[model samples]
Target: MQTTQIAPSNLGVTHPLDMLTPQEISAARQLLVEAGLVGATTRFPRLLPVEPTRELLAGYVDGDDDYDRSVLVTLLDTATGEAAEAVVSVTRGEVADYRVLPNGEHPYGQPQYLFEEYERAQQIAKADPRWQAAMRRRGITDTTHTYLSPLAPGFFPYEGETGRRMIRSLTFHRNFEGDNAWAHPVEGLICHIDLTAGTVTRVEDDYAETEPVPVPLQTRHYTPEHVGPARTSLKPLEITQPEGPSFKVEGTHVEWENWKLRVGFNAQDGLVLNQVSFRDGDEDRLVLHRASVPEMVVPYGDISNTRFWISYFDAGEYLLGKNANSLKLGCDCLGVIKYFDAFVADDDGRPVKIPNAVCMHEEDYGILWKHTEFGEAPQVRRSRRLVLSYFATIGNYDYGFFWYFYLDGSIQMEAKATGIVYTGATFPGQPNRHAPEIAPGVIAPVHQHIFCARLDVAIDGDANSVQEQNVRGIPMGPDNPHGNAFTWNRTPLTRELEAVRDANPETGRSWFVINPNRKNYVGEPTGYQLIPMPGPRLMAQEGSSAWKRAQFATHHFWATRYDPAERFPAGDYPNQHAGGGIGEWVQANRSLENEDIVLWHSFGPTHIPRTEDWPVMPVDYSGFWFKPHGFLDENPAMDLPDWSSYQGVPGTDVDDAGCCRH
Candidate 1:
């Protein structure tokens, strides 16, 4: 859904699930300021719409217009390194709740980095005498064009740095203006700066006495002008919908075919689908209450001092939606499109609108069903799907999240990973176990892009139960006469601990969220199966920092009783926290029987870079599928229009390639 569109108004919010508009953000900031909560150094690290309670939304109808709107703003006092969270009701023009964040005690963590901190960190690094001396040792004196990347420093028990607002920087030299900074890496020099104190706390130079590893100086340009001549062999392919699209949009509520959902965006989670329902016959059956990819961790595999503590929680630490890309037509998407504008808070707690932040459109998906009988005309139907997608850039990597709703009562979420791979400097043909040399003198460390998706299951209604299904081959006995028999077993995940399961590809494992109260035509519980594209879970050893902090990625699936406060997979703030989130929530071991349950499925690719992944890496895809199991009585797409009506021109000769030649 990547296309350009005019930014919408930020004044009218008719629904409780509507995203915070520019006016609402300003009002919330004003309320905080009036309450003496916002000081000169107070910055908005995060702001999101407080999700309305279900009871409040139960009676909601379109055009109700007078609903309550609230914003939850996370405030950080940069001068004192203090943090607090406040909830302000924009409708009532009052502060609802406020509490100081426990960010200075044990399991400490700082708020997300401000956009202005990037420039500040660069200046701090360039001005430091120690950093400048290290640069001089490498024969580089011009620091005007140098780029000091502000990176999240993973938690460590160091004396001066523990429980402090900090940012670690890596220098990248640019030859001149418009030059790609990633091409030249200043290896073996790391700068640690205390953001609150505005001073460099520590400087690590691996080459203070020894010879330094030469930086990768080759111009690894990816842009068109730098790459010289462009390829002209390909022809332009155009897609158009002359009569316009079939989907209808009113505010954020979208309706396409039988699908109905509200598009939601915020600072943390990029795209959230709320109240997803599918029309079955005359009833709009509830499929999911909400769904979103809330958090993901990129844990590098290298053990060098430069990158050993290098696990990054992109959503929690950097905020995916806040850094989302403004999509362009013909480049990011095609066909008839609709774009949704997103408004987020900046450093000063002001409204910042990201125009055309979300993309929505339809795609032609090959054949849905096809058959050619021996003595009958061929029957075929072309498949079409509605796509809602967005892209976000975090540091060097770019990620695209695409959600598809198909006509056959199926849903799919895919994450496309592409961009420049994070690199380090190494001699050509150097042997490195954890980091692979993708290009000459450039090493790309092995890493995993583990994404956790939260699916609030509502098969027929809210009272649903999750059951693990495994298909196993039966032994060659009375049950299996021919030794090729197989049987499947469904084990109810009765508790949170029981639901902490992993994928078993050998047994064809899957999980089903079933409504125990609703029975299908065959007397089976109406259910939707979660099919995982199983891959290796977290590769970090047990008890390691990465394993402890990102426990959500350790298991392929987890089901817990629905709780509004239990939103993020890795707790509220995972920037430098010790460990929380799912690992702590399941301590209660809540029951999962006939109750509203949310499914957390973690899956992604464990990347091992190769030569082909050099300057820019192609898209590496990973995701899961949700489809109707026994929820539908029959094939949902059986009534699809057949494509066998088209007849070839009379007396026309057709070639074997399905082309007509006269």
Candidate 2:
């Protein structure tokens, strides 16, 4: 709990877009305490750095000290369920703005749960008489090892709990301290606990009248100690950079190859890229102003009373960066790595540092381009990419968010989903349509992991427009004499309503952000295309609870005129609110022609559990690409070193690693 002492004199080491340092976090908290905003029950649920305005940044040099630095802290009173947002200026050392959050009104939504609330919910559930009676009926007398999972209670108009801050608890029996709790789910029991009152309002006990479903006795342990075995076939493959990595990091700014960007992290979004640009010739053209996956919804497809109301907004409800994993060397990252430390506020409003929170390294991508004449040696150049990534563990699932920059002026965002699946107990070999049996008695309900990425695009500059391009096939006519001719059509998305579209894989659909003021060598607008990995959108029926809460998932693409307040695709407090995010934003139907705009892309997998997903699931990947369609005149990687130059002579001991040498 030792604090890092920071002063205003050291602010030069940070950019306006950098994540708040431990010193800045503590300074903001001190300003709040001085303003009489801190109470005994007041807790810091979320704290994020407020980015400077575009005008301010346009005038900023690399080490300018006049730019503003601020922090936005979300405060919750755990005793009364009250919430408020405060903006503090660390540079000016004062409170700039403060407002109370209306959390007790209709369509109420509570702030995120504190770390202490998880233990509080467990204590309340175990102390309930009805839950205890149900456990005794199941003949589980030893309650010391019982684990009560604190789950979010999606918004429902149930009596006595309509406007109250609540968390629903599900019981799981653990045999011992290190036992896996998810493997032994106690079916047909739900405990509703009110956080403000510190009591269990109601308990649904299916075993009270009928026979109880037995908890699965299988100990699904995945650690090496429990499953005693070692594979010897694999040989050691060491990835050592005898020279250093190709990327340079000065504070939060990164420069690798022709790509330059600023790194940021917060309690909600784990990693953020700002002021991203690719060097073309002597100029650095802007591509994106800011980019991050701000929110995601994981909704289970089940009709059972045990899990009917289950849709978790991972970033909005439980902060993603708050639960981020401190990455390891060989396990999570390889090669010579550059680590960035992240600082977030704890419940007591103190700075907690997550060391090695962001990992940066270079990866060899096989080949860039190659071609050879009939008689000449093959001319080939190796491809490489700069990767920046971070991982977050939420409940039973762990997610890794990665951002990759290639030498060809392309950017890609990938999300890796891996961990134990959420399971429920049932009869052995039971045939359930909604829930598939992943194990003998364990059934994992079908679910979807939908992630929404916020891209504040700056194609050439801020004045950009969007166009949807789809491939069209020509019928047999003069235009297609051989019946093998097809062309593509680009439609202008001039309004917000027209911009909310879905992916059409059959047409090879993609969206382009183009700057009308700037033109490439071909006389077309300089543009960047957004190519989607098309998949099923949200399967929930329209007007359903899950559908209403996660409207962003219903479409694969959304474009809106840029606004700083519209950072989160889902509304700020999506914990228990009625639907109100991108669903409501597009209703404005504002003009998007030649304006500064933001794009929200929703994409992920709709998972149907399989037998191979048992124990611990391997990494499932889903992502999209933002490539330079016409942003550059030609291939920017033509200057890459030729690998054909490194020829192994007959009697000479030549290492293939020499190909990397210029």
Candidate 3:
């Protein structure tokens, strides 16, 4: 196998790195069968927990370099005669003991169970006489393919959890001649499958249109025969290293420029950064205790049986670390990059290596500072950023998660969504309530991608305060006749409920996390500002199951006292989880003044598809940043030396190295 130059091993990325190892993945598979919960012809087993337990993981993070060797493996037991949800403890390469997560209910949205049921649904759909007749009418042969992608019914299966069930929405494509299968549609057919019975109970074959609406299958964008021309850049620039990469890594700890932190992969969350600190004056000071993506929800908005109740809590539903996408050098990342790897299960329960799952590098962001004083030499400094990113593909959508440290003492967290949209078929001019049509007989439904970032703010010390500073125009009745004056109301959010404030566009509200005891040169307390980026209001209405489960998405920002137990906003098991998470935890109404605090920021964007968004989507981005407000005396990047003698190529720069070539 080919390898990238600066792989994680070269960066000192090591074991006990938080990601589930190959040995642990194999151990988990073996432990499942050893516990007698493996799925058989009649019996069914759905993996529920296959990651480190929170109780044990916290100890490793808070304590010294030593690690606790234990893994938590949980699953659903749905045999033909019996049914229950089980949790098993695996420690030191052996099954220690077992317990149940909740009293009496089955967890939803385990991929293995859904995959098996979807395969079974295919056979049952073929047996139906109406289905056969439809196939004949459409001249559906081996060339016209029929397949199903498993969908969470988003609600309780029939008889209130008697057994686990799923909805398999069938997609028909024209595959006989070429690869433009997506251009064709097998309109409006779905199947409901019962996992325990191993049978398709109901076939929602709604013959909506008189004839099956078929879209063109020879679109050049998808057909293999008409591949697009290669987009080539004549001048290729490669990042080089004379000595080595500027960044230093000792195990999971990383150091570059003035930034230092620990990076690792989690079985559920793809990337986790801990104990983030930056150079203060003579020593490094803590900014955030821990930072990571806790949860992400993708909720589709076509609420019929086939599309309704369809929301995937991505990091939770599909373990991001398990499906980490490998890096491809010049494409996924550039510059002198460092890559990280993790382990996951293969088809036969054997462990396989998922290499280059993470990439780190440095690049020029923009201008750090610039100024001109009359006739004096113009002063300018170029900006550089230390970036760490990882990609994960859950189903058809791929997300790129990034953390950037700027020379000006600012930290930016960003998520980019890019991939093929989840879609269904429709008749001509069929009214779409929350979607748009891309091609004939096809509808790309409306959906939202909501992401939440958890940051444990530890400024100067553990004790910090959050103040909501709102800027608003003064009323005419006050001092001035004209309401031109603006006033900034600096209000301290003392309680958790008070901190659960909305992002007020009218007031331009932003929160400041300050360390009261730490004052800068002018005897003023230093702090960083939390600015919520602009985005859409969540489309999931009140009373909807998705909205109920994701109540934390209602507001833009939240502040609560640091508590390791309160990690995820949508709870650990969001797939049909009976509420109780950040929305409930906030009710404790704990104080947030001069105490150990954590900030929860939510960012979301609604996607109503357009024609241009076919085959694949352009990257849609959303982000928030922690900027040094009063924390820095001046631009910390002032230390960057001026490029006094740099000169650009004159005639050659306009074209290239062209005289000899010409």
Candidate of highest TM-score: 2
Best-to-worst order by lDDT is 2, 1, 3
- Candidate 1 local lDDT, 1-662, one digit each (tens): 22212121235676778888888899889999999999989999999989998887888776665567788899999898899999988777778899998888889877887898888988888899999999888888887888888898888878898888889998888878777777788887899998889999999998999878887778788888878898999886666565568899998999999899999999899999999999989999999999999999999999888888889999999999999987743246666678888999999999999878888888889998888999998888888999999999999999999999999999999999999888888777889999988878888899999999999988988899989999999889899999998889999999999999999999999999999899999999999999999889999888998898899999999999999999999988888888789988998999999998999999999999998886788999999999999998887788887745755343432222222123
Q: Best candidate per lDDT, number?
A: 2
lDDT of each: 0.88, 0.88, 0.67
Q: Is candidate 1 or candidate 3 better by TM-score?
A: 1
Q: What is the TM-score of each predicted model, taking all chains together?
A: 0.95, 0.96, 0.83
Candidate 2 least-lDDT 10 residues: 653-662
For candidate 2, write residues 441-486 as lDDT tens digits: 8999999999999999999899999999999999998999999999
Which ten-residue region of model 3 has the weakest summed lDDT? 653-662
**Candidate 2 lDDT (Cα, whole model)?**
0.88
Write the residue-wise lDDT of candidate 3 on 165-265 in tens digits. 44454555656554444556565566665655656666665564466555445452533346566557666555434345668977568898888888867
TM-score of decoy 3: 0.83
lDDT of 1: 0.88
Candidate 1: give the clashing pairs. Answer: 1-359, 1-360
**lDDT of prediction 3:** 0.67
